[model samples]
Target: MKALLKRGFNLLDSLFSRAFTPAWNPLYQLGALSFFYFWIVAVTGVYLFIFFETSISGAYSSIEQITHGQWYIGGVMRSFHRYASAAMGICVTLHVLREFAMDRYSGPRWFSWVSGIPLLWLLFASAIGGYWLVWDQQAQYIAILTAEWFDALPIMVDPMASLFLNESTLSDRFFSLLVFLHIGIPLALLLGMFIHIKRVTAPRSNPARGLAAGTLLAMLAVSLWRPALSQAPANLDMAVTEVGLDWVFLNPYPLINSWGPGNTWVLLVGLSTVLCLLPWMPSRRPKRTPVAVVDPDNCNGCGWCLADCPYEAVSMKEHDFKKGHKQSVVDPDLCVSCGICAGACPSSSPFRHVDELTTGISIPELHIKELLARTEASLAKLSTDQPRIMLYGCDHGSVVPDIQSSTVAAISMPCAALVPPAFVDYVLRQDLAEGVLISGCCEGDCFHRLGNTWVDQRFSMERMPVLRTRVPRERVRLRWLGAQGTRALQREVVEFQRELAEAPALIDLEDVSSG
Candidate 1:
């Protein structure tokens, strides 16, 4: 368990995002919220499109009727459709920009950024369809321009001109097709969203739900007040300009129109192609484990080591250390070399970091440096009160944000191993102190070679209280932390404070006779 505690929280700065916001993951949140908004836009879009007239003549009347005539479902649905589309576009744009700010796009997340391009295009395409359903002059232009662009593509045999010539593909049919496309394209985008996030586990959700609820309430309220009205019917002949131009969706249309189809084609396809190729981008995954070699002679056969190893790399197969108990054997292939097995060894045999024993390949990384700096800071903030609480945090166990520094007096150490036996004694010697909390990585995945394991034995198993027996007996605790164990660290802090609060005044240990 000590091994699990070593993972530290990363500090991030951007908009409303935090590296580790609550126990609720922020990664899963963004993914889900993006999806939720996509669904929202889709649902509202369907409801609105059902009542919409696609013909340049009737589209304006149909939208006006839906917004003003149908006060309940159609009215609300029309505004919702527009709002949801706008919200999704805004949120996704902000979300991606936030990721960019956080530098999440550069590393393993390159795929996410790459896949996001298609999603953006699909969203805009869907947005454009929403505008086209209004069947206003703006929508007419969009429909014609979009068709012309498709016609320009060599893949299609003059699709725009062919659609205009085909008697079956009238404006009414245009509306139907746009409805079909708006729904279908977003459906495809949803699949892409999943693909973008397939590599990640347990994504974040902080702003997603909150954003959804806020969006729903806000849009609903707005629709109730001043609902949307479709503009005068589209007139390709008159060249009429004024209409309900959904800038969020149709903003690109103006640019595309001005730039000509060729430039837009180059920009869109070029950008999309770049986004799709992100996975090939180089990155790194830190080795989660190191290798371990066990000496058969000192094995206790208690299976504690086996139980302690987080990856299940260590198992007691055959030779029993204690009488008939099976001796532990470690699976080299599965082991990440976390050194939790070394901590669990009951015989108290000293073990080196797996790197030291094998090739000594394990080297300190950036996180380690961060931990040491933070540890020195934590140590300086230690306090001695009526029942002072001693907090021993492994560098990797907790994420200490700058804003949260006031409450926690943190002390960082290389490993739980560096926690000398006397330190606990020294802390306990201080009047008004309760016990000590030694938080390390999860017991099995200790980064150091059995450092926490060694600490566990010398304090708990070997040491005893002089007379009260209770003083040294249970005064020390061992907690295992994972890489993302911010909540655990916080809980430990509050619980330790509470325990100290409940304890009686510190006693003078010198009076107790050694038993």
Candidate 2:
């Protein structure tokens, strides 16, 4: 099932990439787009509230006035509020599904996945409350159905639906209560949104400026084309047999009608429970996942690991052996076992003279020494007569083995970021490979969240452990082709080989060492 969904997402991503570019692709920016739509909903909701009436008798008339009298501004605001809310729901749902399809909602990511479930309910509640405030026939139908739905719960002794039994039973107080809830629930949803991204190192809560502007313009065009208008005023004496519905929020009403309120409640609760437990449903972890380990002897309290970790798993504390100094600590529970911290550690340099070649921070299973040995072995197998290229890829991105050839060698890491910059320099200086190609997850859609970003920054000399300025920039290439980008990776490798063929010979390392 997951494989099928991932393929579908890859196909969509490829199509969207051509239209919006990878950086501005809506699929990649789903989470941020949700935030964008939410702000639109909030700003327009505030404007609508300023002119809203809280009484049942006045609510419908005020809405009618806003729809017709202030058609240019208030009417547009109302439509923006309605449509933006719907867009938010759609974005949130896609964000969840995309995360699941990519298998990112497990292990250390479980907290984000679990925290997001409550947000769906809160969003629906807020939208439903807003509909009721319109006090139209559609709202009337929603109110009565919602009341009956609640009455099915075991905790409700008094039938809440009885409040709408007759024209005299309903009160303005009930209308005011709905107004309060509509405001309060969204505020709560905002808080949940914060908690959802708290563990992420640097969460992107806003989409690109171009994407944001485009979305807003599209929403405006929609509002202008089909302005949101209310139906006739609610009448308890008349039966609500038919009325227009916003399926985004009122989708469950059909289920409630077809499967009884009790059955619908059961279905909703069961679905929520399943989503919350998905992270642990089958356990995606390996038999033994290796976490980053600190070598206090080599550690100088640099704090690079703490900064590079996508999860807040690394911290600093007073060193036990070196008094007054600090050492890095890894929280076992929070660590996702990504080797990005290993790459960030300056001590991970391949030039280290020590026999064991230990680093300040390194993954236990794939230490710096083991990585260098693997790189050397892989390069040794390549033909030196040709333009040898060392291709480094991550487990979650391009399939490295598929692109290996007599002249091109491949090394797969837990993440491309795990390849220390020094390794790239070492490979060139030793003439092991004429060029080094680093490929990983698609731009803006890293499976480990920040792996590819950190790799790019390090290579560009914008971050710590910078790639040496002496090294030829043309010899090092970084391509962010996604997991399904095997063919793309092959094409990039061939292109890099051609570029290296035309470039001048590598610098003389022997002369530099003697100088």
Candidate 3:
């Protein structure tokens, strides 16, 4: 089932990528777009609120005045409010579906998926309350059915539907409740949105500037092309036989009306429960990598490891042995075991003796010492005569292109971010290989989030654990490729080798020991 859904999503992704370049693909920016749409709805909603009257008698006419009286600004605001709400509904639904399809709702990601479910309910209720404020035929249909749906529960003394039987039965108090819900539900949704992205290292609530501008323009075009107007004022005396519905939020109403309130409740509750439990539904749980461990003996209290940890799993505290220095502490539960902290530690330089190369922070499975040993072992197998090149590949990305020739050898790391800048310098300085090619999951699509991005920044000397300036830039090349782009990676590697051969200059090895 997961594979089939992923295939469908991939097709949609391809279409969007073709229409708007991959950088601006709406499919990839669903979460950010949903947040952007909320801003649009909020701004337009404020404009409508200035002139909106909440009482039963005034609600309908006031909305009509806003729709037709001031067609230039007020009408546009109303249209924007309506269309942006619909766009948010679409964006949030697609975002949820895409996360589920990719199995991102499982394991450590369950918190985000579960938090978002209640956000969906809050958005639906908020939109429904907005509809009621219009007090039109469509709103009337929704109000009646909605009241009936709620009255299905036995707890209510008088069915909510009883309030709408006649004009005398309804009051401003009821409309006040509608207005309260319209404002209150969205406030709750804002809180839920925060919780939804709480686990992410750096949540991208806002999209690229270009994408934002494009979306706003598209919304404007849609609003101007087909202006939103209120239906005929709601009349209690007349029956609503025919009315246009905003199916996005009103979808459940038809099911409730057709299948009866009891079945509708059953369907909604059952679906929500299943979605909430999706994380544990799979037969087998994914294996988690070993978390980082702090070595107090080697720790100098420099705190560089704490600064580099993306998950906030590393904390700095007073150390017993080093009075003035602070030691790094690891929170096992919060760590994703990316091994970036080890790379950030200055002691991770492999130029030191094998026994002395330990870092203050290191992953249990891929310690710096173990990594150094593995790298040397891999290099030992390669012959010295041919145009030798060391290939560094990411475990989560493309299958390391198997260079069958004796000229090249590859080493795969758990993540591209795990490769320290000194490790690259060590390989070059020791003449383990002629050139090094660092490859990983593409810049925007890292499996371990910012792994590839950080790797690029580190090598470019824009971030910590930077590749020193003395290292010849021409001897090192970085490539970002997705899992399906092994062919491109191979081509780039070959090209890099040719470039290295043409230059054939070595980096200064004397300065590497100082790092």
Task: Quote each prediction's TM-score.
Answer: 0.58, 0.97, 0.90
lDDT (CA) per prediction? 0.56, 0.90, 0.81
- Higher-scoring candidate on TM-score, 1 or 3: 3
Q: Can you tell me which runs of candidate 2 are displaced by over 4 Å?
A: 283-288, 508-515
> On residues 1-515, what C-alpha lDDT tens digit does candidate 2 reach at each position?
88899999998988888799988999998999999999999999989888888897889999889889999999999999999999999999889989989988888888999999999999899899999999899899989989999999999999999999978999989978888898999999999999999988899999989899999899899999999999988999998988999998899997887899999998999999999999888665434487888899999998988999999999999997999999999998888778999999999987888777779998886888899988999899898666999999999998998999999999888888999999999999888999999999988888888999998899899988789887888899999888878998899998888888877777654466558
Q: Candidate order by TM-score, highest to lowest?
A: 2, 3, 1
Residue-level lDDT of model 1, residues 1-515, one tens digit each, is 21222111122211123433322233324555566667777777767666766564576787888877887888888777777667777768766654543334543355557778878887787678667677766766777778877766789864674454333455566666777886788778778878776644333323445555665788789878877666666655565465556777666566667897778888878866865654343542333333656666655466765654544566676664456657777676555444444434443311223322221011122122233344445544646443344566555554434113433444554455544444455446543236666776544334442445556655654521111234464456666653455686667666766765665444534444532
lDDT of 1 at 73: 83
Model 2 poorest ten-residue lDDT run: 505-514
Better of 2 and 3 by lDDT: 2
Candidate 3 per-residue C-alpha lDDT over 487-512 given as tens digits, one digit per residue, 9 for 90 to 100: 77888778877787777456434445
Alpha-carbon shift of residue 203 in model 1 (angstroms) = 2.9
